[model samples]
Target: SAENVYKADGTIAKSGKLKTGFTAVIDSRTYVIAVCGDVTGEGNVNSKDVTLLQKYLCDNAELDGAYLKAADFNLDGEADNRDLVLISRQKN
Candidate 1:
């Protein structure tokens, strides 16, 4: 279901199942962007993202380049509990 629900560029269109009878219009002038704190690359912020940040903080995992940017929710040049807090507040 997730595979059938993505945009033309292949990112997940929404957090969960697509509602029946719903229609989406793509704006050619604009691009769908990944939300900040989407460290798991799921295109939405959730507990999984927070877990990734936690893993990175504990040195159990590492993030670099684009992943690093996503993990840095505060844009303060580091990944920490503050970023985790921000991400925790985000709902699908």
Candidate 2:
């Protein structure tokens, strides 16, 4: 079902490239896919996600992609180490 989405108003979400998620045939002819809850970005969010999150926590160390994302688990369009502590309290 990774096809295009067509609205009754003649709007189309078109895309020349095909991907795993939904292809929106409306919003600028692109995909309207949602990568939800993928906090780890390892393709899926699961138990091992915490490890990825921890790697990002800087210990007077260098910066990396995982650190960037981990510092801000919610991805509220910002990166702050404060978010990391919040995520650490998760059961998973």
Candidate 3:
């Protein structure tokens, strides 16, 4: 199953860990993937993600599937202030 996953560049994802803002092809189906804390979906976890998460918390912006998942930095099934705080502390 792991071999069926791939990175956005169409290369085999050796570690099977796809980063944010990239796509993953699994069993031939393409899926937009996300990295924990990289809610802004720009491929890295940083201040931008923090700002976006703040807006999302206040309903000022929207985070679709992948982005939303990324926002849930702790994988707690939901994005909230807690996750935002944790993401803020994460280094790229």
Candidate 4:
């Protein structure tokens, strides 16, 4: 699964093989949970996400920290055309 759990500051809190009843405790703060490529947080990755990534790459839109993390398909700590193409080819 591409799902990722992130803390409020947009850093990954946990990842890989998440199971049911998984839990974590942290100081009072918000968190962002989403799939790696699901930048829109729609619980799935699809063509719409591809479009959003394209927009972000073309400077037609902005991606906040969490969304930027999700859009970095190669997990290389950057979002660019390579990531955009990876997102576009995502099967889910």
On TM-score, the stronger of 1 and 4 is 4
Stretches off by above 4 angstroms in model 3 are 1-18
lDDT of 3 by residue, 1-92 (tens): 43355555566656734576566556777676788897865667889999999999999999888889999988989999999999999956
- Mind giving the per-residue lDDT tens digits that candidate 1 earns over 1-92? 12234543455557563322222445533322334677776656778888888889999988775567777778898878998898888846
**Rank by TM-score, descending?**
3, 4, 1, 2
Model 2, 1-92: lDDT tens per residue? 53456332345536433222333555456543333333443344455444544554545333344335444556685544555555555524
Which scores greater on TM-score, model 3 or model 4? Answer: 3
| Residue pairs that clash (backbone atoms under 3 angstroms), model 2 | 5-25, 12-25, 12-26, 13-24, 13-25, 13-26, 14-29, 56-67
| Global lDDT of model 3 | 0.79
Estimate the overall C-alpha local distance difference test score of candidate 4: 0.68
| Ten contiguous residues with the weakest lDDT in model 3 | 1-10
Candidate 1 ranges beyond 4 A from true positions: 1-34
Task: Kindly indicate the candidate among 1 and 3 with the higher TM-score.
Answer: 3
lDDT for every model? 0.65, 0.44, 0.79, 0.68
Best by lDDT: 3
**Candidate 1, pairs of clashing residues:** none
For TM-score, the strongest prediction is 3
Report per-prediction Cα RMSD to one decimal: 7.5, 9.3, 3.6, 7.5
Q: Candidate 2's error at 8, in angstroms?
A: 30
